[model samples]
Target: MKFRVLVAVSTLALTLGIAGTGAAQAQSIAQALAAAYDHAPDLQSALLSAKSSAEDIVRAESAKRPTIGASLGGNYNWAVGPGAVGPGGTNPTGAFTGSSTFSAGLSYNQTIFDNFATEAQIEAARAGAEAAEYQIRNTEQNVLLDVVQAYMDVMTGQQLVALRQENLTFFRAQLQSAEDRLEVGEGTRIDVAQAEARLAQGEAGYRAAISSLEVSQATFQRLVGAAPRNLSGGHDFSRLIPGTLQSAIAEAETGHPAILLAKAGIRAAQAGSDAAQAAFGPNASVSGQVGTSYSTATGTSSGLSGQLGFQITVPIYAGGALGAGVRKANIEQIRSEVDAMGAYDQVRAAVIAAWSGIQSADAQITAAQAAVSAGQEVLEGVIQERDLGTRTTLEVLNAQAELTTAREGLINASSGKVVATFSLLAAIGRLTAADLGLPVEVKTAVPYTQTVEDVWQELRTVAD
Candidate 1:
């Protein structure tokens, strides 16, 4: 009875395991991308960096605003003083102590002029923010490409496993037929042995295919934080390829995130140069303060004071620091120009490569399809001849092997075509989840509330 219970439990566990696997296999590529977009830590970090960069604009602008501040304090004081005595004679007295003193003040300042440095800084900050935004887009593109590739890999692996299993089934049936013929004396013992060997080879291939499929699935799961369930149907690559390489290159030049980022960097460097030049110009400011004080000896008093100031700062003697800064900025601008040129070159190269890959894979697919058809026809003819006793068992086995190879080759060719299509889209900067028609579950910003600029403004107001 104990042994019977153990068998029942084991059977239930096996059934449940298979059921779970089936469930996992039903997830789709769209679902996986959605999950990754929502939860991937790397993407989250990129988004945060973009947000922080945006706050820099506000920080730069804060220099132009008026600031106000207040402070309150109390103090005790002791002092020795000369006192008035009788008959108009002055006398040195003992120490006199004051028990309480209180003071409070409010102050304000405004920047009247600053040689346009503030404006230049704001421009630089805006450029930096734009660069950061491009970086976010670039990171998103990379993530999408990775997810698509991993998802397709899993699908290809699964398809290969299914193909191998089907091939194995055909081989097993053939082996059984050969065995029957041998038992009836219509075939020799060698024929049966050959069939058995083919069956063993097919089984080994099937196992290897299954192992590859498992690894692919694991990779997909690791990327998306969940196993992909029912994937989308086969891709249609007809619409992906551009009519001309020139068109693709043009699109990449205008739309590529990397190129955009480099351009923004150049603009930022220009702004930095402007700011350095502005260091030689003048500045003006205004300040005011109001305060009340209470003391045991002087009683309570209140006063208000205001000052309008205009200060001209000439860069007369900085030991060449300003010139060095300007030189440094010029060098950075040059570097940015080079980087932009490099981006253009990279995009051009990628477009050419992707276009070539697409054309090659398309031709390969056509040839593979024809080969599969020819191989199938050859296999059928050989089998018919064998059944009529005109062909040997070894001939039939060889035909079956040829058919298997043709089918596998066709699958690989199809996969290559699909991959090439996406590569071309990536080269043109058009590879996106939206372009792929993927479903997005959530579209929202990060969780943090107060921006860095907001906090900086509050602190500046207090300081004033």
Candidate 2:
């Protein structure tokens, strides 16, 4: 009885382990996107960069605040005196003494004023943070688009394989019928040979389709960071595509990651310009120091020194460096403006292209669907005629071939429609995992601006 119980427990464990392994292998596209979102090194790097940019605000504010430091040391000295022996003077005297001294002091220097340069720098840092945020959004959009495209490619490839299998099955049935007729002398040998040739061709096509499907699935797995399993058929893309080109362009302008990032660049450059202008203004500072000193041969002494003063730094001479900086900043600002304008044009072009593609794909899908239906009807008629001895096997085979082609065409059209919809969304910067109903962890916004303001307040206190 004990042995039986142990065996039963072991069997249960093995079963559960196998089941878990199967579940792990069967990942959906949505799950893959979630995995990519969590595990992608690039996204993690971008987040770190954003955090680093945020830290820049702290560094900039530090420049306006009082800095405190301390120091300590010890020393030994030896003295020698040479003189003639007369009237309280020694002929030659040499003395050596060692003394240990320690001192610790805290000194503070605060920038009382810096012509708003520090403030401008803080603003620039804020803009940099915003740009980083936009970059993250851009990365997310690109990832989602890639996931969607790869997912659809896999699905379409699988559909093609299925269609090929169906065709092969039909061909095999026809071939069997033709052989039976030929063996009974009801059909000519040519019919049997033709059927055999058609079956061989279909088997080859099926094998090729299967190979293509596997390749597509593998590509999808690599992109999503996991193997895809149990993916449903393609989505209804009609709702995703805008009805009008104007609407599509408007959406792209409003939401496109590239456009937003470019706009952020313009703002950052503007902040830089402001900071450069502030460099020409006056700067003021206040300072304080306190120290305690001890000597081995002398008593310890401690004292505190405080200074409250204001200073204005006027840029008197820089050999044209300041002017050059200002000129460079202005040039950058202009360049950023041009880039932003170019981004807008690019967005518009993408929107228009996607819009046209969606329209064309929709028409193709409709036409393909109609063709598949008509082809299937014709194939049924041909099969009936061949069975009734009114149609030749060759004609029936041709009908089957046409029907297979039509079915494959329909699948391609459907897949094209789905891809075009995603392309449109990506063009507008609105392509995201959430839009596709994929699982992802949404981050809560940190009050970065408020954090910067709090640090600036502390700096003001130090300056005061």
lDDT of 1 by residue, 1-464 (tens): 33223323433443343223345356654566677776677777877787777668877887898788899998887777667685867666664655778888888887878899999999999898888777766777777667778877776776667666666766677778788888888999898889899989988989998888888888777778877676653455447556888988888899888889899999999999999888778777777777777776667565554444444555677899889988998899899999999999997898888788878878887887787678767777777788888998889889778766766776676667666677778777777555656666432222221344564545554211
State the lDDT of candidate 2 residue by residue for 213-243, as single tens digits.
Answer: 7888887777666677766533443466566
Clash total of candidate 2 = 3
Cα lDDT listed for each candidate: 0.73, 0.73
TM-score of each: 0.80, 0.80
> What is the C-alpha RMSD, rounded to one decimal, of candidate 1?
8.3
lDDT of the structure predicted as candidate 1: 0.73
Instruction: Say what the RMSD of model 2 is.
Output: 9.8
